[model samples]
Every structure is written in structure tokens, then in C-alpha cells.
Target: MLILGAGQVRQALDGAESEVVEAVRQAYRLHERGLTELPHSVFLRFPDSARNRIIGLPAYLGDDTPVAGIKWISSFPGNVAAGLERASAALILNSMRTGQPEALLEASVISARRTAASAALAAATLAPAGPQTGVSLIGCGVINFEVLVFLSALLPELDTVTVFDLDRSRAESFAARCTARLPGLKVTVADRVEDALAAHRLIALATTASTPHLAVESCRPGTLLLHLSLRDLTPETILAGVNIVDDADHVCREATSLHLTEQQVGNRDFITASLGEILADDGYRRDETALTIFSPFGLGILDLAVADLVRRTADHLGLGTRIPDFLPG
Candidate 1:
């Protein structure tokens, strides 16, 4: 068995945004082609704290580079109060031939990057024209920060970013990090969520909001909203926008915004199309004037695909510790 810590995984995936994005894109295509096995994510919640939960995402990608794995990640919103990140994760890859555990790796970076890459791929496929003026990041967290990085890679023309957070200091910190990472890019901190939401045609929400809060009254055409945090938007807000999800069955569960919307309308008609289906169809484009929101439930196949990439890279670079006799021979 090979053991890769966070630093190793980070080293493996860092500065490889293009590769990671492409890996996520291929994973989506494979998933859409029904070449993957992804069971519904298992959520473990506590009765004492409704805000904290850990999820188990198991998946198998049977593509040219086949892989099977599960990502165990926890999200505790209160962690940020203690100056700690809200999410921490680990992934385990199992050998398909022998059913033996091949590697154990820290996966928080993998998770964040894959998610951002997925969001970016959605942006590329759905909003190919790219953002003209700038983009707004509603939640100034790790996910949004990574999204900004991937967006910058995909859309080099993007020159500005508007950020908003309930905590003004956090938003300021996020702005500093944004400008430092991508020099020459103008970053602004917004006073209100609505201010950030409507500040640009492209918007990304990656908050830890447990319930629905804000929604734009209207939006201009070609608006691309990356709804990374599943529960931030109200059902009414979702109904008003064109919905594109990573997967319907997985997304319409765990009380996500789409699930809530489904419950309210008693149907899944609010969704325009899956990101994969749209990517599969080259000539399918939606009305440019519609408020198109991509709500990715954070599919596990993406984790598997990215984990495979990290594992292979780290192995080639001699970045992980290996134990040959861990399993019965």
C-alpha cells in the first residue's frame, strides 16, 4: 500500500490545473456514457449538531485509466470559527484486479481542485464566450478561491473579481490571496451578498449556508452561476434560473437546493440538462440571455479520476510512502 499525505498530494496536483480540469472533463464524459459506477453518497449527520456532517463517496471509473475509490470527507461549518478549514478529507484507492487497497491519500486538495475544475469545465462548456467584464465570488472560501484560479486559467481575459462574505475580514483576506495568486487581476470586496451576486455576469457561490438566503431579482443574458454550495439559493431562485447539474439522482438528495426545488415543484423539470449531456452534444447551446446555474453535487467519479491522477504522478515522482507487505500475500 502507498500512503500519500496532504503535502505529497498537493505537490502532485499543484500547478496542474489544466490537467486536473481535463481529467474532470473526461470523468464527466465517462459518467455520462454510463461507464462509471457511482453510488449515492452516504451522509453521516449528528443529532447534536445539524450543521456538521461527513460524507462517503464511493465510485468506479472504467475508462482507459480505470480506478475505484472512496472519498471520506467531513464538513463542519463551525471549524472556521476556530481558524480551521471546514472540510478535511482522505481517499483510498483499491486495486481492481485483486480488490486490495492500493493507496491511501489525503484528499482535501483533490476534492477542492476537482470541484473547482468541474465548475470551470461547466463554465467552459456552457458559457464558452467566457466572462467579459469580471466575475463575482459570493463565498470567499477555499472552493471559491480555487474556482477563481481555474477560471483564470480557462478565461485569460478575466481581469476582475468581486468577493463577498458574511465576515468582512474574511472577504478582505480572500481578496488579498486572490490578487497575490493572480497578479494584475483587480479584486474587490463587496459589502453585501447581493452586491457581489449582481456585480458581474459570472457568479460563484461557495458558502456554508445551511438554509436558503439570497437570490437575484433578475439577471442579464449569458450569466453563468456556479452554485458550488448546494443550499445557498432559495427554491424560487432556482426556478427563476436555468439549472444544469452534474447528476440528477445524486443532486436531488441530501436536501440540496435542487432537492428543495424538486420538492417544491414535485418534479425535476427545473433542470435544463446535465453538464455531461451538454458536453456530449456539441451543438446544444442554451439561450445566452438566461441565468444558467451549474449545481454540481460533487460527484465521486471526479474524486476517483483526480485521485488516480495524483497517485500516478506522486508515484512517478517518488512522493509517497509505500508498504509492500501490508496486505496478505
Candidate 2:
């Protein structure tokens, strides 16, 4: 098996945001083609710790790219206290024909970038046609940071950003980082969630909160809420919006945003359409007056898309560790 480390993954992803977005868009299109088999992610939760226990995502992408991979990831929010990353992940790609492991890769970077790419794609597709002038980011962690970068790339009208985090120091640190990366974009630290939401018509939620469901009353009308954290918006908030999901079944089952709504409403009928359906031109329509919410359950097709790119790039650069022949003779 071939093993690609984090450095290799980062190198492969450098300046590859647009390609990643296109890959994710194609994956969503294939999803609408009914050619992929992606089960709802399996979650292991530890209530005692304010972090996800672990998550296992398995998927098979059909079409021109016939591949299957599984990502095993863990989240430990306390890792930041130790000066370590909050999440760690690894992915295993298997040969479709022989069912043998082909490669093992460090997936943390891929996971973050693919996710950010998806959000950026959705924003480009769903947000208003005008420039994305103002954006409010709810979390200042790794995911939101990447989201900001990709969103800026997609929506060049984005010249100002409002950031908020529970920790004051973290918010300040993130603001400084954004200033460095985006020289002209103004970055402001908001004192509260409402302040953050009200500051920008474009809002991205990437918090670690498992049960944070913000009310629509706190947001401006026509605001595009990018619920990247999965379960950050309440049913009332979601129901009030022109809701779009990556996959209706997957998001309703595992999306932290939709999970709470399903429990409260006892059904998943509130979802208007999947982003794939819209991208596929499958009779999906959007309402201008309604609040727009896009919840993605982090599909495996995305993982495979990014992983395929990484694998190909790593092969060209000779960056990954290769094992002796693992296939039986």
C-alpha cells in the first residue's frame, strides 16, 4: 500500500481550490445520477468530552472515476489546549476490482479543504449574483479558516469579514491571521452571535457545537447561512429558509443542523432540495425572499474526489511512502 502523509497532502492541495470545487460539483452531479453509494456517516459520541468520539465515512464513487474509500476521523477539542490539532484523520483507498487496499493517506487536510471547497461551491451557486461583500464567520478554527480562504477565492466581492468565537483570544488570533492572508479584506471581531450574524449577509457556521441551533430572528433577511458545522441551525431557522442539502437522507440522518429538526418535527420533510439536485438541474428552484441554508453531511464522494487528486499528485511528485507488492500473486 502507498501512504501519503500530511505534508504531501498539503502540497497537493496548494492553490487547488478551484479544482477541488469543480471535483465536488462533479461528485454532486454524479450523486444525482444515482451512481454513488454513500451511507450516512457512523458517529461515536462521548458526552463527557466536548468532542466527537469518532466518525467513519465509507463511500463508493461511480461514473468515470470508479473508486471506493473510507475515512476514519477523530475529534478531540481539548487538543488545542495541548498545542495540537483538534482533529486527526486517515483514509484507506481500495481497489474496486480486487478489493485490496491500494493506499493509506493522511486525511485531515483533505477533509478540511474538501469541506471548505464544497461550501465555497455552494456559496457561488446559491448566493446572490452580486459580489459577496460581507461575510460573518462563527468559528475561527481550522475549518472556518479554510472556508474563508476558498470563499474569498470564489466570491471576490468579499472585502470584509466579521468573526466571532467563544474564546476572545482565539477570535483575535483568527482576525490577525485573516488580515495577513487577505490583505485588503477588513476583519472585525464581533462581541456576540447576533452581532456576527447581523454584520454580514453571508454567514458561515463552522463551530464545534453539537447542538447549536441559531434562530432566524437573529439573522438578516436574505442572508445566506452556510451551516458547515452540520447542526448549527434550529428547525424553525431551517424551515424558514429555502433549504438545500448535499443529500436529503444523509443530512437528515447525521447533519447536526437537520438532526435536531428531525427530532423536534419527527420527520425530514422540511428539506426543500439537495444541492446535487440543483446542480444536476433536477427540477429544483430557489426563492429569493427566503433565507437560504445549505447543510452538507460531508459526503464520501467528496473524499474520493480530493483523494484522487492527492493520489495523482503524490505519484507525480514521488511524495508518499510505498509498500512492497501487497496484492496476492
lDDT of the candidates, in the order given = 0.90, 0.86
Candidate 1, residue 47: the lDDT equals: 100
Q: Which structure among the candidates has the greatest lDDT? A: 1
Tell me the tens digit of each residue's lDDT in model 1 across 1-329: 99999999989998999999999999999999999999999999999999999999999999676899899999998999999999999999999998889999999999999999998888778764544558899888899999999999988888989999999999999999999999879999988777777788888889898888776764456688898999988999899888999999999998898999999999999988999999889987766777888999999999999999998899789898989998887
Candidate topping TM-score: 1
What's the number of clashes in each of the models? 2, 3
Candidate 2, TM-score vs. the true structure? 0.94
Q: Please state the error at residue 168 of candidate 1 in Å.
A: 0.3
Worst 10 residues of 1 by lDDT: 124-133
Any residue pairs clashing in model 1, and if so which?
Answer: 221-289, 222-288
* Candidate 1, residue 88: lDDT: 99
**Worst ten-residue run, lDDT, model 2?**
280-289
